[model samples]
Target: MSKPSILSKLNSGVESSSPPMAHPLRQRVPSTAIAGLGRSLDDLAADSVATIDPALIDPSPFGDRLEYDEEATNLLLAAIEAEGQRLPLLVRPHPKIEGRYQLAYGHRRLQVLRILNRKAKAFIRNLTDAELILEQGAENGGREGLTWIERALFAKEMEGQGHPSKTIWTTIGVDKSGLSKMRAVVDTIPDHLIRSIGRAPGIGQPRWQELVDALAIDGAIKRAASILQSKEISSLTSDQKFVGLLRALCGQSSLAPHSGRREIRSSEGRSIARLSSTAKGDVLAIAKAESRFSAWLTEKLPEIYRQFLIEGATSTLDSERPATGAADSDGTMVVISQP
Candidate 1:
């Protein structure tokens, strides 16, 4: 399908170019009719369109980082000061029935000129409401770049504005998969890591996502977050400490009694410990090198397995009976079954 024109897209809205000036004493030239050599400020104001105060103008629709770069602002101000207002900014008229006007673009220039004029006023063109909202959404949503914190906050605001997570991801123009992973990190990570994720270098969305996946273990999430926050480890890249830390988090200890480390994995609801040994003793070497270890395991494995089965059976039997007829803690006396 074809895309709607800007006005048609905004539906019932109109756009205006006038943002309220900081100062009321400013001269405005209408973009429509301007060919004279040297029009006086007052004559320019008289010949131009309507005037609106700066205070009445809405806050910038683009959110907090509006014209955030001071250097860029300075450059624009210099250009305007040197060349005067060459092109007019686009804007939409007030949507409300009672409001005066609203701005669509040229906010920075309007601000700068108002700073220059300090107290001048002049009229500007009107635009539709649809145009104004579109203007705000475009400026507010389309960012050139973002620091980690800024990106997170942007995501948060988008969520708050009832934008779907997918829509927010698409609107920001980032990879949908990467954005999905970042959202997962934001959702599942510990609070400390959440706060630290955007502030630390090398802790980008991908790294955070990986960390979240690694730390999803029970009780380990908080511990991992604490270790990450430790001052000694904070300087390390998230990736540097991540692998070893994740290994540690998986129940392997970096500082076990052995020269290497201990690895632990779950097996049938029991922790299986793998202990490493480095021995110079010949006897110890023989013990490790021989099949004796495997032989011992083979010999005892069935008994151990049978013991667990018996214990499980007894536990189930005990649980199935009523507590009122259960044996005493000391097993001195008991009824074996409920009536």
Candidate 2:
């Protein structure tokens, strides 16, 4: 289901009545914080409401959205101009900075207040880092302001900050497996590259996974870097940039493997294994034509691969003694090595 737009959230006056009217402007922080994933915007828990200087407050260390919508901001500016800042921003006394405050939520409101050169109405509390993030999540929750990659990036931030896996799961509202997939993408893609592509609100993990696979090919990251810096992508939108990068990369790195084949042979000129590639994937077939060796190969592949990874790809398993084991009672034992 599509998430409700910021405009829809703005029109929902089910919580509070109109306030007195205000003006516009913006900056966001880089943060990994999200808590109370189901909380509503107007329902933040606070001690009291008072007006404070927007300029004195800084955005939270964690961020939610990838990019702000200018049209949405204009709509927000018009609304506050008529309603007079009905909802109060959530803030706390800065833990480190003596004279300043840290904003928990209401980033857009704070921006507008800063532009109007007016003080912001806010609920001030002495909040810990965790608590501040939760308050911020409460404000952003149910708004669907975050895109798929944005959530992944936010999840990456949460893990980086030492938040336990369970905490991250609850905060981001994703399962353990979901978090794992997000980590894979963030781990494979460089941070600056993700920021360059922007939010990619229209793109999902599957398409992003394509880029991940393409990048895994040797020299693919360099190819991707070149594509990102090209003049063609420089003028594209965020989603457009992603499409262009993926298209360029697919043509360069991914296509090189298709319609390719590698056939191994023994010193005696006997066939060993035939490796063929297609759009679907690579297929490896052993010429032994014996079920026992195939079974042995299947059972030992993981162990062989694990050793290769642990020791480094430069080292081969050919030097090791051949694998040995008895087969099923009716079948013969087969010895096979990485050679």
TM-score winner among the candidates? Answer: 2
Best by lDDT: 2
The lDDT for every candidate, in the order shown, is 0.47, 0.69
Writing each residue's lDDT as its tens digit, candidate 1 over 264-304 gives 33324333333442211111111234355446545765765
Lowest-sum lDDT 10-residue window in model 1: 277-286
lDDT score for candidate 2 against the true structure: 0.69
lDDT (10s digit) by residue, model 2, range 8-35: 5767876657674564324554333321
RMSD of each: 19.8, 15.0
lDDT of 1 at 46: 35
The TM-score between candidate 2 and the true structure equals: 0.61
